[model samples]
Target chain A: MTATAFAFAPGDIVRVKDDWPERRGPAHIRTPYYVRGVQGQIVRHLGDFPNPEDLAFGRPAEPRPLYHVRFKKGVIWAEDRADDALLVEIFGHWLEKP
Target chain B: MNILDTPSDRLLAAVRDLLAQKGIATTAEIQERIAITDRASPGQGARMVAKAWVDPAYRARLLDDGAKAAEELGIPMRGMPPLGVLENTPDTHNLVVCTLCSCYPRGVLGYPPFWYKSAAFRARAVRDPRGMLAEEWKTVIPDDIRLTVVDSTADYRWMVLPMRPDGTDGWSEEQLAAIVREGDMIGVTVPTIG
Candidate 1:
């Protein structure tokens, strides 16, 4: 969807260019258990990742890009995966430019 | 100065004031419900697994989204955001640890279990996982299976989905749940009680 579609919500897809080499967790606010340090592209933008206005107890403001990062289950849970393919879609901020 | 007037004491006073205003039954009720337990404490996640093993829809939702899945079971996740649950099938086993800090799903799972927040467990788990398991929790793993320890932190929360134990074709939901302990949910122990 167009960024305009998001009004001031900060919408639009951007590719992950890189990740902090020494960070503890992923870059996103709400990261997944197995998605740390994983690389992927943003397929779509879901408004601002956490618009300030939508915050539980914070000032009203658009958060950040919350993209959908797709990963093969094989890459993540492959250590003991039963199936050859396991597909998962996680949020955008979860990824860094990589 | 009034106890309620101090700045540092304001938050606690406010809580007391609110409780008094509502005529809340007692501090015990509040304590029992709001107390923080270790995330990996002995039987924390065991409770959730017990709940899910008996409830089909709950199990499906847990497999889908652990945060909402937890809410459906009446677990409150106020401070803990972005919860994710992982399932362990016969072929795969999942373990959780926070190498950086003790970040856990306290809202749904309760306080971080003692072993979770311990420095020894933290340092040794990352260095020698197999040894830590055998020595600390007394968990023994076979040589064939692969083991991966997940790290929970500021941005993410994790839970393990344990494989269903065999042999009980017609066990009641409660019966099955009774057997799924917290250790199983953490990947240190398999579900054998039920």
Candidate 2:
């Protein structure tokens, strides 16, 4: 089956899908735990590429749009001391409008 | 010390031998791939940045399409991951990290540093980027400027285009390239004129 496609522009706020429980099994996962379920803004569209989550299991990779999402210091760390942003590349399927 | 004697190394050796025995891939082909990775260095990335500094049109193209722009400069980018060039301006700074793995622009910047692959860096880079930069890299971002940390997690790898250092007007591209270190391109530090 083909991969589900979604359009996301820069500056759109998105929350990463919290799939920690489902993804606990043995598989190469790329999403970091800190940013899961956190809200961030889309920095850029990194183009469509094969999903690594599926590719890790020796399955045919379904192409998905990867994005660079920027999270503010306050959103990520509870005690915000730095005035900078953190950006992470998240697949389209793992992001939702927040 | 022979570092390639571990269990993982043995597994890789077995896999390579199996592939060769099955005629799927030759040992020579495997060595060629290893050579490609070893030959790539930060100098390649510095040259691209120097060229961009001297040429505005080239800079535009480099930001627009990093892989194509690199190929135009005779940098072999075929069979490599897509490259994204992040430009650092006066009001903004860019930092790169691979939280999941050491995903880097190996074709342009060679191998990543040892610290880059560490779990500490992966966790702290996104958690406390400014603190990590200050304490680990000795890079202090001014309070006014916005710092953006990029995670190279997927198929697209990234590199930073640092701002041209002052007091280097009319300097040759080669001279500019001389001061552009790997740390500068990774946004761990900025380039300086001597």
Candidate 3:
């Protein structure tokens, strides 16, 4: 199946989608908890790939653009002394223009 | 012995047995895949890095297409995730981590170090990378240099192409490869001239 095209590009500021339904029990989720709702900048366009969330359940994945999202150290941690950066691979579906 | 098996290990063995029973994959094929993993090591990565240091065209290729560049060196990359080579420079340093799971470039760098797969490293590498670098790995980055941590959470796996150490101008590719540690490729430390 053709993958859904992504609108956002590298250098775009984005916020993680925080609307996932609350898990009833332990589930195989790829999105990290700390990044949900956090704002970050897209560092690179990682091209299209199968959505890993569906792949975990042995289902066919609809491909989506994955991006390397960069969050400043201080943004993630309040007490961080350095202004270093962290890049997380996030699927297009989990991000929105902020 | 059963107590020693982790849940994942037991699950893998069960899956393998079932697959074998159904004639989906022969035991030899399973063993061969395991052997391919075993044969992979840091030496394979070091050779690529060393070659890049000497050959500008090859370096460009390495950065442009990591898996194809590896194939130029006869590295088997089939069934592995796409590889991304991040270049380290005087102004920028690169570190790689997998926040969601232990996704790594096993085709080139062999098995990851124990810490690379740890919960603590996964979290801290993205949260406070500079602190983790100094306190845990003993590698210090100058304040002027920008540190970019690449998270290998998707289909593309990443490895750092570290800056060649100074004073190694006359060194052979083999000699250069010797000093390029697995940690250096992982970006926890820089390759130093010794």
Candidate 4:
């Protein structure tokens, strides 16, 4: 498939879809389990690229928008690390409006 | 020497044999790739850091597009993942980790350090980055300073543009580059002037 417009812009708060095991079936997923269902702000849209999940299987892949999402450490860990943050590169399909 | 003593050694040999048997890639080609990878080291990244410290234009370009900036310095970044550089400041510090695997800027930093690939590092980098840095590298990130841990878990690879150490003023770019160690670029340690 051809490249399309980005879904999320920088500063947009989005949530990761927690469907890796049930729907994705674990085929070279880049979204870490820890960030599943976590909300983060989009730092930047890193343009569209072929989905590595599909490319790993030698299948025809379509370009997907990728964004650098920043999550607070407190959101992912039990510790109250409000000053710490994690920047994750997540594809558009794995993200949704929170 | 036992070539296949370890699982990784055995796997490498088996894959090489299969590739050669199928004429997919020759053994010499594989060795050439290894040579290319080995030639890449933290020194390449240190040069970029040093140049950015002195040249504002270069620094802006480096922040805009790390791969292109690396190419400006004659580093061949073609065919490698897009390089993302996280700039460090007095108020904020940056660290790079691949929670999934050891995803790193191999084109610029050669290879990820052994500790960087450890399970403990991956698990704690995002959990307790400030604590981990103080414990392992003895580099403390003050509570007032924000710590940002980047997970290079996808298409783009990441490296830290560490803040230039104080008291290095009036130093040449090459001289400044000498003090920028591998750990500094990895964000495990900071570059110090001695």
Which candidate tops lDDT? 4
Candidate achieving higher TM-score, 1 or 3 = 3
TM-score of each: 0.58, 0.89, 0.88, 0.89
Mark the regions of model 1 whose C-alpha exceeds 4 Å error after superposition: A1-98, B1-11, B14-47, B54-57
What would the per-residue lDDT of candidate 1 be over residues B100-141, giving only the tens digit for each residue? 567666666566667888888766654456677888778876
lDDT per residue for candidate 4 within B1-194, as digits (tens), equals 57557689788898999999999999998887888689999999999999999999999999999999999999888778899888999998998889899988988899888988999999888877888899988999887888899999899998899998889989999999999998898788999998
Candidate 3 runs further than 4 Å off: A20-26, A81-83, B1-14, B20-24
Query: Model 2: how far is B43 from its true place, Å?
Result: 0.5
Cα deviation in Å at residue B146, candidate 3?
Answer: 1.1
Q: Which ranges in model 2 have alpha carbons more than 4 Å from their true place?
A: A21-24, A81-83, B1-14, B20-28
Instruction: DockQ for candidate 2, please give it.
Output: 0.76
Candidate 1 residue-wise lDDT, A6-65, digit = tens: 232223233333344337642323343445665433433333444322363465544454
TM-score of 2: 0.89
- DockQ ranking, high to low: 4, 2, 3, 1
lDDT of 3 at B117: 97
lDDT per residue as tens, model 2, B67-181: 8988897877877899999999999999898988899888899999898899999778777778888998899988888988888887888999999999989999999999999
Tens digits of lDDT, candidate 2, A2-98: 4445668899988998778444677676777888899888888888888787797889887888888888867778786556777788888889987
- Chain A vs. true chain A, TM-score per candidate? 0.46, 0.86, 0.84, 0.88
User: B140-171 in candidate 3: lDDT tens per residue?
Assistant: 98889999888777788999999998899989
Off by over 4 Å in 4: A1-6, A22-26, B1-32
TM-score of 1: 0.58
